[model samples]
Target: MIISFIGKGGVGKTTITLNLGAALATYLSQRVLVIDGNTRAPNLSFLLELKEAVSLFDLITDPKNIVKANTEIDGLKVISSPIGSNAELDFEVLKSLLSFFNLSFNFILIDTPPSFTSETLTFMELSDYSILILNPEPLSVIEAYRALQIASRMNVKLLGIIVNKFRQDAVVSLEYIRRNFSLPILAVIPEDPMVQTYTLEQKPFSISNPSTPAGRALMELASYLTGRKIEVQLEKRGIIGTFFSLLKKLFT
Candidate 1:
């Protein structure tokens, strides 16, 4: 499945995509490929701790160069920004990367740059599933609507919106998101400081502190994606079965 995460900046789009890909990586033995489509500020590799992986920038700028894949994490491989320092984005390069020989990955997650840039709009057309990440804030809701408008025009399948930073007393906000988007809130991640702690440690929150409220919500999301009949946990992280063969290869 080609899932692209898009939304306004700082709304946790990258975080969700990173953990989502990570969660899937643990469950499936097939490779999970994550491309840092956020050209302005590519952080998917950083979030997933593949600081040394090849980046999207290079692939987009010069397709002739092979994108070196890194096996930093089990079942996960990454491409980073290849000289993506505010450079003019080449959408065609990205398209080739998505459709190239690497299309056999079990799940491919693309992290888009904030806003509806040409690159993002082009990716919208290429992705089979696009998820807009929204917070309880009004601006984020409007941004989600804008994203929906763009995705609709681009012939993209919007999977659903994920409500991040959910609070107990955010009924009005939730109702607004539910009413405006007219799509189920795919998942609701509660506000928690454990996320901050994980960031400080440069680890995905769902992996480092899988017992937090946020982590369980992520597992539910994984169960939905995988279509696996796994029980959803509320306070503890659900351990997706790992490939024993892959794990042995990982540590050996």
Candidate 2:
């Protein structure tokens, strides 16, 4: 399946995509191909800990060079473009390139830009499913809904929504998110410091520390995507926290 990950700039879309790709490759033995569709800010290369070498732009531009350029990191293959490279995207060309990769890879995960740009639209058209990431804040939810509207208009199958950077204390915001969006809440990722630490180190937290709350939730989300019905669990806090968590699920 071609699953595109979308969200606002700071919503951790790339992080979630990398972790989910790692989980699928490590646990399910899937040949996952992660494509960095965000040409302006291609961070997938950095997250894969790879040098900005031959990019997807380089490979797709030359038809005679039919060979796919990718690097295997952890257990998945990644196709990324160098950051700040002004390689414009042609939808037809991109569609052909994705079609080529789709035949060989089990899953194609495209990490897209936040806006409704040409690049993002191309991926949406090519994707079989989309996973929207959002925070518990009102503006984030509003932006997510706008993305959802675009995805629906483009006829992309939305798998679900992932609420990232979830704070246990934000009861009102959480309640608003639950009440507003119509798609299934795939997973609620906690605000964990390890996520930032791993990002700075350019590592996948699910692979490095699966025991952490955010790590475990991401793994469960991976399972859910792979046809398994895994339940998402929150961190165990005190009685007041438990009450709020129960309230968070009322709109589910």
Candidate 3:
């Protein structure tokens, strides 16, 4: 299975994608391959502390290059951003890369660029489903919808929406997005400081602090995507929260 995480700028898409990718590995206990496909602003290397690693660019540009991606955690592999990144994505080269990499893993998650680009479009087509991450800002919502439109235009199947960095007082709530897009809001990760700490400390939140509310939420979200019966502990936030979530679900 291939899943690509795409969304708006400054919406914690990379951060969430990294942590969620880690969470997905733990949830399934399988060898998971996560690649930083966003060549423009590659933050996955920074977040995961693998800046010097050989990236996709190396794989695409070099025929003689041989590499094996290894992660600190077992059953997880990562292909960090290459030495020299390029904004213009070569669809033919990327398609070749996808075919080469697809043979090595049972599940692969790609951390994508902020907006639709030649690169994003290439990866979107390679993926089985696209996970569109968004915050609770109006512009974020609008851009996410734009991404959904792009997916439709390319005929890519979207997994659903993962609402990260969301706050209740959010200018635009999840309800607005569901009403507008009709996509499943797989999970709403409320605004939390633990996530920030994980970033500062340079550890995947799910791996460093799996019990944190946000970490648990990501795990549950992964379970939902994989069709597992994980307990829904987040139900305690309150009836009003649940009501609005339901309303948003209906609208979406």
Q: Sorted by TM-score, highest first, which candidate order results?
A: 2, 3, 1
Pairs of colliding residues, candidate 1: 54-80, 55-80, 55-81, 56-80, 57-82, 58-82
Give per-residue lDDT, candidate 2, residue 82: 73
Residue range 1-252, candidate 3, lDDT tens digits = 788888877888777777877876765675687788878677777777652476776677773332456667666777777545664667888777777767766678888877777777888898888888888887888898889888898899987888887777889877788888868888888887767766765678776666667878888877876777544333243335434655776799
Candidate 1: global Cα-lDDT? 0.73
lDDT of each: 0.73, 0.77, 0.75
- Candidate 2 — which residues are off by over 4 angstroms? 62-74, 228-252
lDDT of 3 at 79: 76
Q: Candidate 1: how many backbone clashes? A: 6
Worst 10 residues of 3 by lDDT: 230-239
Write down the TM-score for model 1. Answer: 0.83
Candidate 2 lDDT, 73-131, residue by residue in tens: 54587677777877788878888878877887788898998787888888888888888
- Choose the strongest candidate by lDDT: 2
TM-scores for all predictions = 0.83, 0.83, 0.83
Evaluated at residue 238, the lDDT of candidate 3 is 35
